[model samples]
Target: MSSPGPRRRGVSVPRPGRGWWVPAWAVLLAVVLLGPALAPGLVLSYDMVWVPDLTLRSDFLGLGSSLPRAVPSDAVVSVLDEVVAGWVLQKLVLLLPLVGGALGVVRPLRDLPLPARLVAVSLFVWNPFVAERLVMGHWPVLVGYGVLPWVLLLGRRWRVERRLPAALPVLVVAGSLSASAGVVTAVALVASVGLGSRTRAAVAVGLVAAANAPWVVSGLLHAAAGRSDPAGAAAFALSGEGSLPAPLAALSLGGIWNSEVVPHSRTGILAWVSLLVLLGLALAGGRRWWSRGRRDAATLAICWGVGLGLALLTWASPDAVAWVAAHVPGGGLLRDGSRQLALCVPLVASLAAVGTTRVLEWMEDAGAVMVAAALVVLPVLLLPDAALGVDGRLRAVDFPRDYADARAAIDEDAGPGDVLLLPLASYRQPAWNAGRKVLDPTGRYQSRDFVTSDALVVSGTVIAGEDPRVAEVARALDLPTPDERADALVRAGIGVVITDLEAPGEPPEVAGEPLLRGSRLEVSALDGARSPAPPTGWLWAMAAAWAAFVVPPVGVAAAAVVRRRRRRDTP
Candidate 1:
């Protein structure tokens, strides 16, 4: 493999010098594209579930676990709600990753001219995959997607220089915030080490494992509890409609199962265009790697190869995907293999940046700018409707006043036992949400701790977890006799039964007086069994694991800052 020589009108052209302006321009472009998300009101959608009433939990530190994914975004949302009354914080939390991802894509192109760098950033951020994920409400994975390139960059520096970067811990924490992203980051780190120093890789791995101990411990506890669900694993296996081939989806980066999120007419066009651009750039990058054998390029090639290979396997082979999901710990976390294709985004973006620079060198400055501008704007023009709100499909809307009132009422009346939310469904079509797809918002609105029977829905099937309480609750609701139902509720340690009045059914006649009756909700107190608390040892163990994950990263980051300051003062 060799770098293609730049030629223009039969004359050779020289490469441009590195400059800081390209990154600054890339940041500006990202902010402009993602600016709408920063609007004043909540942008509600399927998985982008943010409510002002949601509170932080200590279990958020548990790595390789579900709760950990919401921790980062929840922190931001909570803080914003306390300081401000609008959706500005939620929007910023969502858009921050896009900005980081844009900068990550452009940063490696420091050697390239401004036009080419901008084109690469635009293509990376504005692609169909990003748009689809945004619509699907997987912003945490997107955050991981944004931080990945920087993680690789920092990991490479550590491997080569034998000194960890100050930002390495932060990047690791960001990347590991989501389970899918954590798996990708762990794999990338090991791969980066294989390409460089084994000793440095071991040290880096140790620190990462320490930082992720909370989730790892939680995962271990989950495994010990025999809570694994094979049906859930199989349901999450990668497969696509016959219309879109798995390989093409991997290349084009658009295998979203939800048809509503994808633009029907322009999907094929965007897919093919992205496929061709990425393949061409990857070929060029591969050639450069073969010739020079640079560690960075090799690491990127490995990432692209792994991401593409896994995506293809998951998408093309159902049995293989199911097998992996069942056998591989935490594999079930990635219900959509298309999300893994995000790893390829940065690699492709980097190659595209190089390709853009190469193509520009063959033309005059003005011609290069024109070509770059067209390339940068092409994806956006093709998928014009795939912005933050999916072109108005996901507009911001306020929750009804009744929701707040119900939450307040629950806080005042509910006992230590959990509130049982009715309808026992994983999803809801709330009247207030404008018919948009959303997770059950009862979890978000209730002030008292609550439980819902909404098992994780996959492939239109409700895959039940180890908890039999949801099933028990469903049975209790069907007992026919009010006394039996009341006894069942008591046995379940349910202090209050909150029924969604908007949930398309008449309220069940229970034995107790209605505590709070509103247009949207009805709450009734249940007297029977008390919910048992976990053993004291379990709580302490979780706390210890959380401390392990948090303390070292803070210390390392502080030490790095102090060392830098002391060196500066030495002058």
Candidate 2:
């Protein structure tokens, strides 16, 4: 419960008059790390897709025919995109973690010297975990990851005061941008605000649970909630790039499943050396950090242990993982195992700071202060490629002009019947995006009901898609004769078809003559469509679920009103 004060005399990284430099340094680091990601154009890497105009749709709320993997993040973006430009919103989403994380991570460690706080910021923001997640375009996860340390800071205060932080709901909601983000945030909230007092814990848990309602209610109401593809468990399991052991790789915060996202230096000897140094530093700090009666330390330690343990479960026991994924509703969310590793970040950063402090104190030489100052940017030195938008892997690119033209052409003739994206793929490796894999943006760009594939092909293995309509559409399109295919598609509600030339695969033989053709896109209108009406059964449920997010604020407002009345009455 007591702060470990400074280990010895303070060493100024800049000139430690005040701690103003902490946040300023964080902003600078964010600018450097997110160089191209903040450029004029949108960042459309892998899962991070931002369209010119994102409209509110059934899909955004998880009521679409396809899987709701994007869920509330898509919904949130659509809401924000109404006022803010898509490109700017994308930058904020990208910058939230890198900048907010540095600010959050240093809050608890302010008791330490300025140098130690700088070390925490650098380690927390510039590490492999943050880099890999950024490159892979999991911005929502990064948002939650950035919020973890702040949760810790507030949790410590909550425990001491026996009253919840007023900002807890806001923080939890911010963290719950996506289902994965929601899951992690809820776990963290529970861990940080433990059941020391039943009433306080209940209040905290209820608010946090309400924050997660968007995904929780949607996932449970989903038809496939009880069943998920188990094969993905093996496909997305965490590994050490086949160079280091899984545990050490995870401990070092480097083992992401997507080998392409892992920094080039991660496989080299320097990486191993860095990992050993990090472990040594953590051990050095843990002696002082993980002592008796400190609830903050316990919360972080529990998180690290549980996070690493679950991250390893998929690797250590594949069969068990497969069973769980198959049997549990929304268990497939955990298929990408490294997501759990996010919980390890707050603890590790703190340890690194305390460890740096102890190290500086131990080294009695005058130059030791100078040496400790260098530790602030050690994360950057160790993982140099993480800067400058992951070595230009995440450069912002404008959508080709054809996309806008196609959307307009399709919109004019688009009736009740659904539009189908041709070449029938979930991802597009567009040339404009430098051949980077991005989720097809056509659906969001045009405010229409566009049906596309959700199936993912990892390596050579094809994981089955969640949308049952995709297979039916594919079957209808694959009929023996062009006439038969066209007739079949028309009767089943294929209104307009848009084909992307940049994406691999030819347009359907049944696509007939193009209504509007561009260099990269071709739109064809189909007639005599009879599309089935979208299910409206879950609308009330979803509305109620969304309403839960509002309840906490209402409660807070009511509580404040009551306190005012009590003061007035006493006087």
The lDDT for every candidate, in the order shown, is 0.65, 0.79
The residue-by-residue lDDT of candidate 2 on 1-571, one tens digit each, is: 4674755554333333455688888988888988998889998888888886898877778676666778778888889988999898888878877788778877777667777788888888888888898888899999999887777777778878887677677778888888777777777888888887898788878877788787777787775634567888888888785477777888888677888888897888768877987988888887876652377788888888878887888788767787887888778877777888888988888899888877777665566677676788788888888889988888888888888887787767555567788789889988889998888988788777678887888898887876777877889988888778877777767777888878887756774547778888888777777666655768887888888876776677678678879999995
TM-score of 1: 0.88
- Which residue pairs show collisions in model 1? 62-214, 62-215, 63-214, 63-215, 490-529
lDDT of 1 by residue, 28-85 (tens): 5555555555565666677788776565443233321122335444543454577765
- State every prediction's TM-score relative to the real structure: 0.88, 0.94
Per candidate, the number of residue pairs that clash is 5, 0
List all candidate RMSDs to the true structure: 3.6, 2.7
After superposing candidate 1 on the true structure, give the runs of residues whose Cα lies further than 4 Å from its correct spot.
Answer: 1-36, 58-86, 193-196, 224-235, 239-242, 283-286, 289-293, 324-329, 364-366, 456-459, 504-509, 568-571
Model 2: which ten-residue window has the lowest total lDDT? Answer: 9-18
- Model 1 gets an lDDT of 0.65
